[model samples]
Target: MAAYQDTFTSIPLSELATLAQSKKDEGARFINIHAATVADGFVLTYTFTSNETVTDNCQVHVTADDVVPAISPLFLAAFVFENEVHDLFGINIEGIAVDFKGDFYQISIETPMAVPTKPEHATAVNTKYGATVPVKQRKGEEQ
Candidate 1:
């Protein structure tokens, strides 16, 4: 069996939607979009698959305040992932085809997966008792 390696390409946030469209034009199917909280902000990865075995990823680094352009205009299935990232990580994605306005999930806390940007915003978890608690108070975690 041949080994398949996924390729990741870093792209500017301004080119997110454009890149998605280009990938679609190149006969790639939109797979999914994922988000991870970083020290400075967030890293959002958009994945596409082509030729059944080749995977291409476009990564965009953005702060919480950065407004990400929604690609749902080109790929209708992207609305779900866009809403998920926005509701779960506090990413600011604009112009979604079907905008849920942060009501995608029934979670109590907003941006529960978001990394706190300030010292006063240290609380990163919500306890089962409906109380908020602070996790590790660090800018970035060492893996």
Candidate 2:
């Protein structure tokens, strides 16, 4: 079996929507949208299937305050993935066909997954008897 060549590119946040539209016009189908929070900013990867044989992936780096334009205008199915990225990563995505406003998952915490979560920062658990118990830290765990 032949391996597929994946084309990866990083574009500016300002060009996200336009680039997506161009790729869509080139007959690419939206596959998925993913994001990760870094010390400097957030990194987003948008994957597309140009055909059965080729996949194209684009990455965009933006600060936490940048408002990323939604590609749902070009790909309707993108709204779901875009919303998931917004809800979890806390990066603002504007112009979504169906915006969830960050309430898609009914999560109690806001952007809990945006910043790096430390094991030592886990929430305290309360016993059934009304006693509060701290989370047990494993040995060699970073403080």
Superposed by TM-score, candidate 1 places the C-alpha of residue 128 at a distance from the truth, in angstroms, of: 24
lDDT of 1 by residue, 60-98 (tens): 998767899998888899999999998898788999999
In model 1, what are the clashing residue pairs, if there are any? none
Per-candidate TM-scores read 0.79, 0.78
lDDT of 2 by residue, 1-143 (tens): 35787888999988887898798889888888988766566789999987656778899987766789999988998999888988876778999889988878787756656534433222211111133334465689766
- C-alpha lDDT of all candidate models, in order: 0.79, 0.75
In model 1, how large is the Cα lDDT of residue 44?
95
Q: Give Cα distance to truth, residue 2, candidate 1, Å.
A: 5.2
Q: Cα lDDT for residue 121, model 2? A: 23
For model 2, name the residue pairs that clash: none
Model 2 RMSD in angstroms:
7.1
Q: How accurate is candidate 1 locally (lDDT)?
A: 0.79
